[model samples]
Each structure stands twice: as structure tokens, then as C-alpha cells.
Target: MASINVDFSVGQGAISSRLYGAGLEHVGASVYGGFWTGPARPGDESRSAPPVHIGWREDVLTLARALRPGILRWPGGPFSQSYRWRDGVGPRGDRPLRFDHYWAKPEPNHVGTDEFLDLCRWIDAEPAITVNTRSARPEEAAAWVEYCNGSMLTSAGALRLANGQPNPWNARLWSVGSNNWDMGAPEAARRHNLFARAMRGVDPGIELTAIGGNPSNQSEWDKVVIGQTAEQFRHLGVWAFDGVASVEGDNPEDLFHAHVASAERILWTISNAAYRLDEMMLNGGAYVGVDGWGIWKQSRQGLQHDYDMSDALIAATVLHGLHRLAPRVGYAAWGNLVNALGLIQATERACWATPVYHIMKMFRDLHGTEATRCTVAGPAVAAPGGNSPVRSSRPPYKGMALIDASASRDVARGRYTLSVVNRSFSDRHDVEIDVKGLPTGIGATSHLLRAESPFAANSAKEPRAIEPFVFPIGQIPREYPFPAHSVTVLIWEETPGLT
Candidate 1:
């Protein structure tokens, strides 16, 4: 019998502000065809009609609000550096036509700055714009910020007014580039650096994020870029940092593990430089390969490969990493909101939330206001490469029990929630939580999400593949079999006298 003990007395710290927000870049149909089609005409109900009203989708807005996302990235990943603000502004008819370097599609400029701002308003999310840095100039970057955030009295402000948005937008969160290091082309870093300098001159208060290298060379890039850029902005007295991480994988399990390891590596790199983790975005969660255009596919084969039984476990791993390293990590965002690795998938006719979405919602709803310290003491599960210890260890946890736990306390409510993910595929582990020293009592409500098959998913036709169940904790007794491939959220409330 494999058993584990958890002590909730040792508290970690407060939850990170970054945990509150997510990102939606201009990739796939995420922005254009995905979320931003205008509302249908008075009588037309066609699926092709714009799914989002005023270039925003209601389903996407609803999901974003549920997460209480603090900030949303806009306009581009690689596309941002090549994007021209003028093309995305002004009347849609008059807006210039351009090519989206990333998705290989004609840039319609339909969801311009004003429209994005409107979408943000609808969802109640803060707008974080990424300016064109590769081929753009400092003056261009500064002027764009002025156009959006500056007062109406300025020239750029006048241009914004002429474009039908009377007042300056007052956008605060901004970035210089996206993966400027990976294009492997000439003048990439130089263009990004120039944009950074000019953006500071526009509005000193705006938060600026500089692009770092790829995940493979993250540490090396951090050492070089942060070392140099820190000096450039030292005189201007602005906040400067790097943007790292990308979304690509087959299933939630593998993707989740990669995200956990990547985050740790990036955090370590940024910490060594004493630089702030300003705008670190996680990999894509919604994208599936369609005609080999994106990393994942839309077929069941692709879905099973990328998002099956591993998704819930992966999500647990991510939450645990963020909670444990709350002090260093800030501003973590998922790839998109609607389609292409998003939480919600919407067609003009209908909408549905993914299993990952439910997991995220559960985390948002139950995880308390602050992180608490908790550790697992149980039989060691062997690593895949055998129990023999070797130099340069990479695996964070050893063994097969696959136990991950996060504890949080709500000071005002006098409640604590423990979220645990058991990764064992065949055997069930018996968990014993030692709550003797906890300030609160032991009664708890447990919510479990599990499936018989690892490759299960919720489709438009069949929408109930994955769901949660709630039951009294004590009813199950000491030997609770946490079914194979499952996520469990245990809510413990205090008994008035026991405390």
C-alpha cells in the first residue's frame, strides 16, 4: 500500500498577481476569423457571420471574464514586429492590405486597435499591445503608444480621434517583440532594441517587455540581452524585461511537463540576472493541426496525441510550479482564448468548453487567496531510467506515484483548499493528510475529475466526456483510491470548536 502525508502548517506565501491574467496573440483564427467577426445582420444566422460582435465573440468574452484575466496580449507573436498600426486603424474599407508573416494569410486589419480595445472592454481585460520591432523604428513605436494612451491634445491623439476613437485608450501593458531571436534573420535584435528606446520616450509609465531567446538557449540569451538592455534603459529609468516561451506539443501531459520545466529554466535565468520576470507567456493550449498549418491537428488522432489523459495532470503540474515559485514568476498567460489551443472552442452556431477549461475554472474557484507550504512523504517512485542516481539530474520528482499537491488558505473565509494530481496510470495511492496543527477543522468537500479512458475529449456532438463530482470527504474513510489519471480538489472547512 502506497501512502503519503501532507502537513499544511508550513505556509509558502501569497499568490502571484500574474496568475490572474492570460494571453491571446494573433495566431491561427484566434483573433481574425476565430473571435473577431462582427455580429450577424438583423436576420442572418449563418455560421460564417461574424461570431464576435464588434469584432469580439461573446463566448470568448464569457470565458475570459470567468478567469478574471488581468491582461491580454494583442496583434502578433512574430506578426507584431511586421504589423503596421495604420493598416489596423481607420475605416475597415480604407485600411491597407498586408501579409501576416506568421499564418500566411492576408492581413484584413479588421480587428484593429480600436476594435481590440472594444473587445477588452467587453471582456473586462486589460489590453497589452506588442509593437512592431523588427522592421519598425523608435519614433514609430513611440507614436503608436501616444496614439493609444496619450491625451487627446496631442497629434497622435488627434489621429486616434480621426479614426473614430475620440479619447486616447490609456493602454498600460506593452511589449517590444515576440521571439525576435528565433527568426534567425538579420537585424532582428537591433530593431527590437530601437523600439524599446523609443517606447520609453512615449510614456515612461508603460511596462515594456523585451524579447529573449528561444527556450533552448534561454539562459544564454538572458545573460546577453538583460545584461545589455538593463544599461540602455538605466538612464531612461523604465522597467525592462524579457518575453520567453512558446506553445507546441501533442498532449496536455507532455505539454504540461514541458511548460513546468521551461518555466523553471526561465525563472532561474531571470533570477541570476536580477531582472524582473515581466511578461512570460505559456505555450498554446487550444491549437490543433489543420492541414498542417499549426503544430497540432483537429482530428481525434491529434487530439488524443496532444490533450488526452495528460491534460489534467499537466494543468496540476503547472499550477503547483506557479504556486511554489510565486515570488519570481509574474504575468503568465495561456496562448489563446477561443480556438487554437484555447479553453473554449466556438463555432458561429454553438460553443463548448474543453476539459482543460473546467480544470482551470476549478483552480480559479477553489484555490485560496494565498499559497501555503505542503510536502509529500511517501514511498519513492522510480524514475523511467531506473533508480540509479546519475550526474546532472533533470527530473524534479523521482518515482511512479505521480503525486502533486498545492495548498492555499482564505484568511477571511477560514477555509483551505488542497489540489492534488495523482499521475499513476495503473495503481491507486492512499493519501493521509495531517491537519492536526491547521488553524481550521477537518471537514472537507472533495471534487474529483476522472475518466476511464486517457484519450477522452468533449466534442460539439458529445459534450459531456469529462465532468466533476463532489462528495463528503469522511464518507470514503482512510483508504481512498484516487483513480488512475485524475485530478482531485479537496476543500477543508473548520469545525467551530475543533479550531
Candidate 2:
């Protein structure tokens, strides 16, 4: 049996909602068949088409709106490194169809800066754009900031007005390129700092993010970047992913715990970086961005993943871990939004949410403002290694409990939410959540996400194959039985103490 102790009085900083962010890139069908429709044919030069008039799917937009993503990272993964922003802007008819060198696909260039910012407005999500510092010049990056957030009197702002938008989009977060190594040549950290300075000269209010290594692996690089260029940026980017494939004949349950350990390593890295930044006395508080993260064991030409029950459990645990590490992490985008390693799968006629999508929505909507400290006390299990996509840098194997849990508190709203991830394959653990230093709750609701088999996944025909089910539970019992390989979120009303 596993027991969770949640002490509301013992908490870290406020959990940032932006940690539950999503990203969009010009990869595979993510842009072509995922967001747009009505054919990729050349448009009539006479018609002067803006993206709003272009075939953006209402059904997909409806699904995107449901997640209520806090922020949307635009125009890349690798695409940002070579993305030519000027080519994608202005008249849609004049925009050229260029070859995306990164993904080796023909980019239609229909969705540009304005279209992406417009989509953000429609969904009410903050725009987090990554500037090109590899193929493009620093001037181009500055011009992009001006076009998005500059005043109407400026030259780029006039072009934006001429293009159609009268007001500035006012995007806040600007990522100054990604990891780039020139085949054993010079790295791009210094170039990244130069671009950051130029972009800031354009809009001093925008938050700049610099590309760096994961918290644990890059000791020297982290020290140099934070010590040298820490004044130029406010956040550092960290990318992480895992595969559920069997390693040394390990089972799916072992893979699930390994993912948890990997996420914990990411948190540790972020905390270490934050401490380093503080010691240097940087101009601003530097946080971390887990910008690219996912669990993909399967891939196709477009990197499609049929997320299974085990993936859903991993997603829940990862989000739970992020909530606990709120003091150092301010943003996270779930690698992608559609087509390639996405939460929702798209086709010509229909779009459906995956098991990962349901779990993401559950945590995003149910999470609160503050993280409540939780400790899991139970018999430990040895977690196997080799879950990460990168070799030779797998998370260290440690004794982990079968139950992993995190809790959040909304003091203003008088609500507390607790999420538990059960990684055991066979044994059912009786989880007793002891609430201390808090008033008793009057009502409670428990939502459970589980599948008959760990490998069960959802298809278009069976979209709800692995979805969450809600049930009203009895009085906060001494202990509750949590089945093997399941995730449960319990929401209850707490009586607020007198101020």
C-alpha cells in the first residue's frame, strides 16, 4: 500500500499556468492537413487572400480551444533555425512555396506571422515566437519584434498595418534560436546573445529565451551561458523526450517509472540552473522552459504517434512533476500540438483527441495556483534505465515508489486538487491522503483515467477508448484503492480559514 501526505502549509512558489503550454511547427501534416484545408493549390493573384479567408478548420480550432493552452510556441522546432519570416508575411498569393530544409518538405507559406498571431488571438493564448539566428540576420529578428509589438509609427509596424492588422500583436516570449552545432564547428551561444541584444533593442519588454543544455548534462555550458550572457535573457530552454520501447526485456510498468525519473531529473536540472543564476546576481530572475518534451516510441514519415494508455500515464506524471517544480519552471510546451508528435490527430474530414490529450486537459483545467507538498511512503521498486531518446545520458536508476503523486491548492477559490499516478502493473495500492492544517472538505469528485490494457490506444473510430471517468466519492476515507497502471485526480472543496 502507498500513502500520500499533503501539507498545504508546506508549499513552494505559485504554480505557473504557462507551464501547461503547447507548440505548433511547420512539420508533416501539422500545418498542411492539420490546421489548414481546401487544398494546397496556388491561390488567385487577383483575390488578395489573408489567412482568415484561407481554409482554417473550425473543428480543429474548436478542439484547440478546449485545451485552453496558456501559451502557443510558433513556427518551429528545427524550422525556426532556417525560417525566413519575411517570405511568409504580406500577400498570400505572392508568398513562395519553399523547401523546408529541416524536414525536407515543401512549405506552402500560407501561415505566417500574422496568421500565427491571429490564431493565438482566436484561442486567447499568448504567442511565444522563436526567432531565427542561424540562417537569418539579427536585423531580421529585430524587425520581427518590431512588426509584432512595435508602435504603428515604425516602418515594420506600417508594413503590418498595410498587410491588414492595425494593432500590434504584442507577443511576449521570444526564443532566440535552438541548439545548433556546425558539424564540430563553432557553437551558437555567443550568436544567441547578440541576437538577444538586438531583439531587445526593438522591444525591451519581451522576455528572451536562450538555447542551452538540459539541467543535469551541461555543467560547463550552463555555467558559461548563465555567467556570460545571463543578463540578455530571462529563461533557458531544455528539451527532453522518452521512448517506451522495451530495454533489456523490461516491461511497460518499468518504462513508466523510468519516464517519471527522467522528468524528475529535468526538475533537478532547472533548480540547479536557477541557483546558479541567483549566485551570479543576474539582472532578471532566470527561469527554465521545458519547451520540447514528449514520449514517442513510434514514428512515421510525419512522426505520427498513436498514444497508448501507458503514454497517458507518463503524461500525467510529467505534468504533476512540473507543478511541483514551479519555483524554477515558468513555461513548457508539449513538443507539438498536431500531426507530428501531437495530442490531437487530424485527417481530411475529422479530428480526434488522443489519450495524451485527455490527460493534458485534465491536469491543465484542474491544476491550481500553488503546489502542495506531497510525500509518497511505500515499498520501493527498482526503476530500470534507457527510457530517454538520447543514449549514454539515460536517467540514473533509483529506488522509486509505485505511487507518484502531486497536489495543488487554490486559496482564493477554496479548492484543492490532488493527482496520483500508480505505476504498479499488478498490485492495487490503498492511497490514504492525509490532509493536515486545512479545514475538512464538504464535497469531493474523483476522475480516473485507465485502460483495460497498457497498450490500448484510440483511433478515429474509437476516440473515447481511453478517456477519463468521473465519480462522486464518499467522505474523505482513511484510504482509497488505486488500481494498477492508472491516474486519478481528486477535487474537493476546502473551507477557508479566517483572514
Candidate 3:
């Protein structure tokens, strides 16, 4: 049995709702079959006439809308470094299908800048465009900003007007370049500064995010980039997709324990990096933006993996950790929104939300903006050695709690929400919670995400196999049973009067 104390009077920080954002890359079906699957070309007269061409499938769009994605990054993930924006815009018949050197596939360029923006508009999502700096010059990247956001007086803007878009896309978020360690040139930092200046010159209102450093080691790279581009960028970009897998004849629970601890360590590193920024004395308060996240499973052609319930639980833990980190983490986008390690799997005819999708939706729809401080006193579990999910210089910390939790209070709705993840493999712990500075008699609603087994998953055939089950409690209980390897969210209306 575990007794947890949650103090609503103590506020950790404000949770950034955009932290739950997801990304879309131009690789694999993520674009073609995933987003742009119209019967006719985008600019064709048939697209506007009867039997109009819907670029994105209706069912898929409807499911995505439910997730309420705050921001969507476009046409990237190593593809953007070499991508030529000019090739994707204009009449579909005139646009060229170019060979993608990175993915070694033919890119039809049918869903170009205009198409991407149109999709964003349809979904009501903020556009986070990554500019090509590895293969394109600063002026080329600057032209992209102008085309999307500049007035018709500008050259690229004039082209946009000629192409039929009367108004600017007015995109605010931009990533300077791809990962500098892999594809970036030695002078890429300087080039990023040049790109930032040129793009911002076109529209100073836009927010620029530059590569801070490799996620593995960010100190040196952070210092280098901050020295070069002091105040040009608003956020320093970082990527994380840590996952656990069972080895030969090993227990699966071992992997889940290791994965949760590994995820926490990575978050701590991000927080440390933000603290170090104070010593660098940068101009604006720049936060870490984990724009690329999700397991990078080894594959031949595409990055798609059948995410199990354990994977979904790990993702829930990650989301909880991000929300707990609060104002330090400005935004986080799950890798590939549609097919490449996507939350929702989509075929031409149908789309199915994965277990991870349900978890994300639950957190996004339920969690509030203000993070509250919480404490847990329970029998702690230790992650076994040599079972570390990722290579780390240090071992897992001693006395890591078996139960991980985060809480928030929504002021406008007069509600409070608590997200808790039980990391135990086989042991079901009794959880007793006390909310300081609060009265009783509050009605509570609980949403539980669990399955018969951690390895359980949902496929296209069984989309709701591991969905959430909601129950209403007459009052907030003094104690509850938290099952092993599960994610639970408790929400209640905020009591106005004091006890």
C-alpha cells in the first residue's frame, strides 16, 4: 500500500499545452497515403468542381482533429535538409517528381508548400516549417518565409499570389536546419544565423528555432550555437525517442521499468541544459523544444512499428514528465503524425487510432495548464542493472518510486486533474491520496488505460482493443487500487469554498 500527498497550494509551473504537439515528415506514406490522397491533383479544376478532391481523407482528418494537435511540423526529418521548396509549389501538372537522395525514393512533390499549408488550415493547427539549410542557401530559405508569409510586394509573395493564394500563410514557427551533427556542415551554426536573419528580415514576427545540440551531449553545442546566434532563435531544438525492447527470452516488465527511468533521465538532461543557458547569458528566455520524438525502430524502408500497450504506457510517462517539466519545455512533437511511427495508422480506405493515440488524446483532453506539486510514499522498485534501455554513462538512481505522478488545476473550468502511472510489473499497490488545503464531497471522474497484458496492442482490425474506460465516483476517494503497468487520470471539479 502507498500513501501519496498532493498539495494543491504548491504550484510547480504552468504547463504548455503545445508540448503535446506532433510532427509530419515527407517520408513514406506519411505524406502520400497519409495526408494527400486526393483522386485528382490539387490545382485541377476537378478539385473545385462537383465530386471535389479532398487532399486528406475525411475519416483520418476527423480522428486527427480529436487529438487537438497544437502545432504540426512539415516536410522534414532529414528530408528537409535537401528538400527544394520551389519544386513542390505551383500547378501539380507542372511540378516535378524529384529523386529523394536521403530516402532513396521518388518524391512526387504533389503535396508541396501550398498543400501542406492548406492541410494545416483545414486542421486548424499552427504550422512549424523546417527550412532547408544543408542544400539551400540563406536566400533560398528566406524566399520560403516570404512565400508563406510575405506580402505580394515581395518576389516570393508575388509568386504565391500568382499561384492563387490571395493571403499569406503567416506561419510563425520555423526550424533553422536539420541535426547539425549528422547533416549539418561545419559552418552550419553560422549559416543558421544567416538563415535566421534573412528569414526574420522578411517577417520579424515569425519564431525561429535553431539546432541547440545533439541530444546525447548538448553542453558544447549549446555554447557554440548561443555564441553565434545569441537572440535570433526562440527555442533550442532537441529530439528524444527512447524505447525499450525485450531481449532473448527475457521478461517484458524489465524493459518497461528501464524505459520509464531512461525517459526521466533524458528529461532531467533537458532541464539541466536550460539551467546552463542562464550562464551563457542569452538575450531572450529560450526553452527546449523536443520537436522530434518516438521510438526509432530499425527498419529497411520506413520507420513504422506496431506500438504495444507498454509502449503506450511509456509514452504516457513521457508526456507526464514533459508536463511536469512545465515552462522549461516549450513544445514537443511526436515523431511522424501519420505513418512513420505515427499515433494513428491510416490506409486509403480507413484509419485506426493506436494505443499510444488513446493515451495522448486522454492527456491532451484532460490535463490542465497549471502543474501542481505532489508527493508519494510507497515501496520503491529498482530497475535492474544491464537492463538500461539506452546507453548511459551513469546508472539508474536508487529508490526510484514505483508510482510516478503529476497533477494540474484548470482555473477556467474550476477543475483539477491528476495523471498517475504505476510502473510495477506484477504488484498492485493501494494508493491513498490527501489533497491539502481542499475540502471533501467533490465528485471525481477517473479514466484508466490498461490491458490484460503489457504486450497487448491495437491493430487496424481491432482499433479499440486497449482504449480508455471512464468511471464516475461519487466523491474523491481517500484511497484506490492502482493496477500494475497502467496509466490513470483522476479529474474533479474544483471546490470553491475552503474546508
lDDT of each: 0.59, 0.76, 0.76
**Candidate 3: residue 123 lDDT (0-100):** 68
- Could you tell me how far off, in angstroms, the CA of residue 492 lies in candidate 2 after the best superposition? 1.3
Residue 202 of model 3, lDDT score? 86
Query: Model 1 over residues 344-424: C-alpha lDDT tens digits?
Result: 666655566666667767776777777876776555443321111111223433334367777887766666778877776
- RMSD in angstroms, all models? 7.9, 4.4, 4.2
How far is 268's C-alpha from truth in model 2 (Å)? 4.9
Better of 1 and 3 by TM-score: 3
lDDT of 1 at 359: 73
Question: What would the per-residue lDDT of candidate 2 be over residues 143-209, giving only the tens digit for each residue?
Answer: 9999999988999999999999989999999898875544111246788778988999988999988
| 1-499 per-residue lDDT for model 3 (tens digits) | 7777877667888887677778888787887776667655556444442222356666677778788777888877688888999998898889898888888889888888998888787766778999988888989999999999988888999999999997999998999997656643337678888999999888899888878665565777778777777678888787765554433347566655655565565566567667666677545477777778766533526475567777776777788778776767788888877877888887655578888888888888888788888777777767643232343333545666888788887767777888888878777878998877443567778899988887788877887888899888757668888888788998887653211
In candidate 2, which residue ranges exceed 4 Å CA deviation?
Answer: 38-54, 181-187, 214-217, 250-272, 275-284, 302-304, 386-396, 494-499
Residue 213 in candidate 1, Cα distance off native in Å: 2.6
Better of 1 and 3 by lDDT: 3
Clash pairs detected, candidate 3: none
Worst 10 residues of 1 by lDDT: 286-295
